[model samples]
Target: MPATVIVNARWINEARQTAGGLRLENGRIATWVNDRMGWNGEQLAGMPKGPRLESDR
Candidate 1:
């Protein structure tokens, strides 16, 4: 599966602007609403997997 990087932002879609649920996929970013427009999910399966970050304090 490709890696998805979701960021916080409000975006415009189809002449209407909306907020919430914004995200970026396959190195390309867009609001959640526009994700289905042209998303091909490329480079997703090659993403590196690793353990969760730990506290070093």
Candidate 2:
């Protein structure tokens, strides 16, 4: 699975001066952490019914 990285932001309960980061996998949140809080993915599932990507145009 491919992974995406995000930076330069605060997560959870934290002061405005704090910063945090996150990682995403399979279009779901994988992990999130900051100077004050942290979290990880438990389960991620896609919608059973949704618009097709090809029809987005």
Candidate 3:
């Protein structure tokens, strides 16, 4: 289980542009964007069990 989830990250590094969600479990990255997509109002009914943090944009 993740303690926090960050969605729609537009992080840019020297290598490439990174985007998408990141799930942190136990102070570490447990899940990446490739594993799960951003959450939406439609998915609220059956949301995953965890605390998620998302941006307005």
Candidate 4:
């Protein structure tokens, strides 16, 4: 899976969770930076490399 970064993300549900950025590694969430308005955002690193697509399929 490709490393991902989502900004100003919100969740609409019973928990009503929110995050400044959600990170994913190996197709699963690796970390979540909680909601903070006016935030400059965050950096996620040290992600494990995923299987190369050319061989994965």
User: In order, what is each prediction's RMSD in angstroms?
Assistant: 14.1, 15.2, 13.3, 14.3
lDDT of 2 by residue, 1-57 (tens): 122211212111222212222233332323332211232322212222232223222
lDDT of each: 0.26, 0.25, 0.29, 0.24
Candidate 4 or 3, higher TM-score: 3
Candidate 1 structure quality by residue, lDDT tens digits, 1-57: 223211111112211221212233324444333454332333212222321212101
Residue lDDT tens for model 3, 1-57: 232223222222111112222233222332343234354323422433333333223
Alpha carbon lDDT of residue 46, candidate 4?
24
The better-scoring model by TM-score among 2 and 3 is 3
For model 2, the superposed segments whose C-alpha errors exceed 4 Å read 1-23, 26-37, 43-57
List the candidate numbers ranked by lDDT, top first: 3, 1, 2, 4
Greater lDDT among 1 and 2 belongs to 1
Worst 10 residues of 3 by lDDT: 9-18
Per-candidate TM-score against the hidden true structure: 0.15, 0.14, 0.19, 0.15
On lDDT, the leading prediction is 3
Better of 2 and 4 by lDDT: 2
- The regions of model 3 sitting more than 4 angstroms off are 1-39, 55-57
Model 4 earns a TM-score of 0.15
Residue 30 accuracy (lDDT) in model 3: 28
